[model samples]
Each structure stands twice: as C-alpha cells, then as structure tokens.
Target: MTRTLFALNPGLDRPAIAAALRAHGRVQVRQFLHPDAAESIHEVLSRGTDWGLAWAATGKSGAHIRGPELRAMTPDARARFGLEAGQSASKGDFGFLYAQYPMVEAYVQGWNPGHPLDLLLEHLNAEPMLGFARDVSGIAEIIKADAQATLYAPGHFLTVHDDTVVEEGRRLAYVLSLARDWRPDWGGHLNFIDDDGDTIEGFIPRFNALNLFTVPMRHNVGAVPPFAPVGRFSITGWFRDK
Candidate 1:
C-alpha cells in the first residue's frame, strides 16, 4: 500500500547548519518554496518536452513513452550546458523519465530577467533563507535556477553527482527540498557522498529542509519505495553562476 506523505514545513533551519555548511563550501536546507513556485514552474514546464509523468512506471515500451511531448522555449542560457529541448542523452539513468521535461542550461546565457523566476532569483541572491552565497568566483559562486518534477518508484534512485564543472566554472548548488513526511526508512535519502561515492557524510532533507553545496562532486539518492511503500515527491531548485 502507498503511504500518504505529510505536508512539508515552509520554514526549516538548523541553528548550527549555517556554520557547519560553510566549512564544507556552502549549505542550506529549508521547506521548499510555496506551491506557487511549483505551480508557476509547471506553467513553464508545459512549454517543455512532455511525456506522461508516470512514464517511469511503464516499461521502455510503456504507454507513456508513446504519448506526446510538450514543446518549450530553448533559452540561449541553457544551450551552454550542452542542453537541448527533449534531449535525454545527458541526464543519466534517471534520464528516461527525466527526458520528458526539457532541462535548460543556466550558466553563460541568462534566464528571463523579469519573470517570477527572476523575482525569486533576486531575493535568493541577495539573501537566501538559510545561508549566504558570499564568496566571489574565488571560493564559490551561485547561479539561479528552476527544475520540474519526475516520477520515480520503488528501486528507483537518483545517483549521486556533483555540480562543479571546472570548465563551466560553476560551483555550489543550493536546493530547496520540497515534499514532506519522508520517513528515514522510506529510503529516499539524498545521500551526500564523498568524492569517492563510498561514504555518506551528511544530508539535510525533510519537510522544510534546505540543501546547499558545492557542485561537480558526486552524490546520489537512496533507493525509493517497494523496500517501503511510500512514493517520494519533491519540487527542487538550484542556485549557481560563475
């Protein structure tokens, strides 16, 4: 049986997290942005490539893959990352379900400077909810971003990865972890792996927890349900620029 998740708390911050994360590079964890962020992002997603959100459940020959894909703008900003509308080649094993939503590049080019996305960006850049992106490109820098949803069930896992690309010169990824009532045993832990991926050092995900870190390292999410019966859900985002 599937278990219903509890609502996420909008405000979450461990008093010591700020100081601790700074030692590593950067870090923050809090409730995800409002449903407005999720709903509004959905509006933008409609313009992206489409596939049934449930495509993960169906086999490669599944019914969802045969469905129509939505078309969205290919922002010049996203092109730099070698991203393209409807491109699934780069997203990895999670790519199948991840492919349906168009992923945009967010380094060199720019996002819609005046949209709500920008509003959030402005607020975050100046003063994030938990930690601060205070260093220049010297130590770490942060950009702005948005991401859509995907479906992952039991046995599904988002492999650990890092955001730092030396050539890309982008460091630090700040995410607002959305979704709630995630049990430790539900097995959807966003394991923060060390450079080797052999050990889990830290994690900050729960209702209202915010996660911030340097990128291009290596990390992965723990396995999903079936080991447990709860499906995981979250709307997340990152901050980066260099």
Candidate 2:
C-alpha cells in the first residue's frame, strides 16, 4: 500500500444521512470512506498501531495502561487485571475493557511523533471532515472532536451507560469500523438498551462503516465471546461543540 493522505468519499448522500439522524438519532454510513482510503486506514489499524490496555475497575479513575506498561506486564498480571475488571462489572460498576490507542492524547504528547495516526486525528478535526460532521448532525458549533483507536478482543466489553458528560461538550459519538468478516456470534456488537434493560437496537461491526449517534443515549459494546478469533477494530470518539 502506498503512503497517502486520507480523503473522504466525496459522494456521500448528506441529505439522506441527515434525515436518518433526525429520525433515529443515529445512522450508519456504509463505505463511508473512499475504497482506497478505507484500505489504507485498515492497514494502519491492523498493522501500524501499537495498542494499549484500557480498563477500569471500581474506584479507579485512571483507565489507560499505555503501550510501554502493557508490554511490561506478564501474562499472569494482564489476566489478573482482566479478572478484577470482570469482577467489577459483575457487581454493577461502570467499567470497560478494551485495547485502545488514545489518538488525541498521543497527538498532544507526541507519543509516536509524525505517525499517520496523528495525521488521521488532524484530518478528523479539520475540514471537510469537520464540516461534513456539522452538516450531517445538524449540530452547528461543532468545533472539534477527539478520538481513540479501539480493539475489542475476546471478553473485552463496555458496560451500558449513557454518554453524559456536561463538561466534555460531546454532541454525538461516532465509530468507524475497520473490522471485516466479523461473525454475529462473536458478540462484539454495539447495542442500545432501553430503560427496561432490553436492547432496542444493535449494530454489528462492518468494514468501512461509520456509525454515528447522538450522545446521552444508553448503549454498550457487548462482550466478545471467547471462541471469537478476531478483534473488533474501530476508531471511536465524540463530536464536540467546544
């Protein structure tokens, strides 16, 4: 694959996407990026990114375990951490366990100086991608966005919660999937749950699909089954007004 700047498809149906957002508060744009661009992006996530562990347990405010620390952990230590996180979830705590590359944080700290992921973050925050987000969501004053690369391996999950942060200025949450050939039984789907604890809708991870939804909606990334052979790869974050 050639090293190239990321580009939007230019042929997206903005009006249709906008309409769907208005009706359902969410929409999935399939083939969201140009084919070549999509392939290039998948290559970055699949082979280029150095993933880290992102997990949370009760009373733990710091969630990220950066790549270096993750690499230093023994297999037993990693499993112990996972077990603790699982235990927290079983006890009704808000917790999540997934591999993450904190894009915005990395860009700020120069973690991988001059990497494409940094450039990708810039592409998301600048035009025409920024402008496109405004047009589709009808949420003007969306000045920026923050992102993180995520890989949900077997047993990784995000528990149900509404994305509500008053200080964060988050208007909508988005996910761009790089996962392909994912099976339904693998169980890493994004599900919207109702107040009654029932799933109202769910979206499977599909290659090159962009899933966007209004914030403050109850949702969770379902836990992957142990028998699953692949990770659910995606770049996810929120569109913000700040």
Candidate 3:
C-alpha cells in the first residue's frame, strides 16, 4: 500500500513566523514536518531512482544556460555561457555531475493515487499549510507553487543568484532539508549574499527544517567539499503569485 504524506508537526505559530519573516526577510522553522512524514520523505528520496543532472552556466554577460544543453557546448559556446580563462581550466569550473534535480512532477504523476510525494504536493498546495504560508509571508495572492527535489553530492554547488527572474512569479523561495548528521564542516550551507557579494547570513541544512526567504535575495548553496560522505537532499522550490 502506498503511504500518504500528511502534516507531522502539529502547527506553526503564525505570529512568530510572520515576525521573523518581517524582520529578516527570511526565516527557518525547525521540526517543520511531523517526524514520521519527514522520515518517509527522506527514505523516498534516498531510494529514488530517476534523477537528471542539471548544470548552470553563468556567462560574463550574466546570462544562464541550463540542463542537457550544457553538455555539447564548445569552448566558445562555453565562453558564451560565461566560462572565463582561469575558471575554465579546472574540470569542475563550469560544470558538475553530482548536482542533480529530481523530477518531482514525474514522481507525483507516475505514482499511484495515494503516493506519498503526490500527497505531499497536495498538502503543500492546499489547506492549513497553504493558508499559513500566505499569512506568514504576507503574499496573499500566492496561489501556486513550483518545486523539485534536489541532491547535492560531493563537489556540487550552486552559485549566487536572486530568485527574481520575472517570469517565474516567485514570491518566496523555500527549502525543506532532509539531510541527516549534516555538519557545518561538510559545507553545503545555504548562504545569503549581500549586495557587495559577501555572505551576510547562512543556514546549515538541518533535518526536517524549512528555510524560506523573500524573492530577489541573493543566495547560493556552498559547495559540498570532496570529502563529504553523503548528499544534501531537499525539496526546494518557489511559492508563486498567480
């Protein structure tokens, strides 16, 4: 029988969460999911079979090239995607295979009616959780979501970028971490960037924690150093205004 993903945590304290969002434009909620639900998600992701490699090339012009298209890019083509002389010398400079984006929509769509991921997506887009998200983020018009599962293995990293691509309609960005025994030294921390390109604040990927920030904030996932033993897994995406 398929398991249904349901709220594990009793509820969020709306006032406190809102206060944090208002004060810092970001917030982290610990014990965000019910223990059982979180465990189920972790298990599913850990055992997941279908995942595609995703890479992003940020050109000097600041444009981006993503997904499978990155593979056949020539040196000149790579440069067009923002690879520079020194940056291109290293193999890992402009690309990485350890970084991946799991097709969540496929998982949900291909599963049986009561599949956990399907139920979880439904839970996120509906009910008390949706209402709570609106109230805390103060984005009353947020009616949809765009989310996917992500895996950051050794040497995987995401560079700085604001979640402000106008077409995405992203009002808020969120990450629900599912890594266990994650240590600061392992280096997959999510760091918020200041205007000057310095890291102003950072959050470790704690198990069952939900971290959220307003759109257009510069941020990046610190590289997972080579020695790290496990992948940093999470369900990450945006809350959109429709």
Best-performing candidate as measured by TM-score: 2
lDDT of 3 by residue, 58-151 (tens): 2433222334555666667644422342254254333332334444455555734555556567777876667777989999989877667778
* Model 2 alpha-carbon miss at residue 167, Å: 0.7
Candidate 1: residue 242 lDDT (0-100): 41
Per-residue lDDT value at 18 in model 3: 91
lDDT of 2 by residue, 19-70 (tens): 9999999888998998887888888888999999999878885388888898
Candidate 1, residues 1-242: lDDT per residue as tens digits?
42212222345334455566657654555544455554444444344323333222211321222124222423453232223211332344322233222123221235334443334434554545313444321344445444434334464455445655565555555544544566676766666776554655546346445566666656666656567554444444455454
Instruction: For each candidate, give its TM-score against the true structure.
Output: 0.52, 0.97, 0.80
Clashing pairs in 2: none
Model 2 CA deviation exceeding 4 Å by range:
1-5
What candidate 1 gets wrong by more than 4 Å, as runs, is 1-17, 26-28, 31-67, 70-132, 135-143, 166-169, 195-197, 202-204
In order of lDDT, best first, we have 2, 3, 1
- lDDT for each candidate structure: 0.44, 0.90, 0.73
Top candidate when judged by lDDT against the true structure: 2
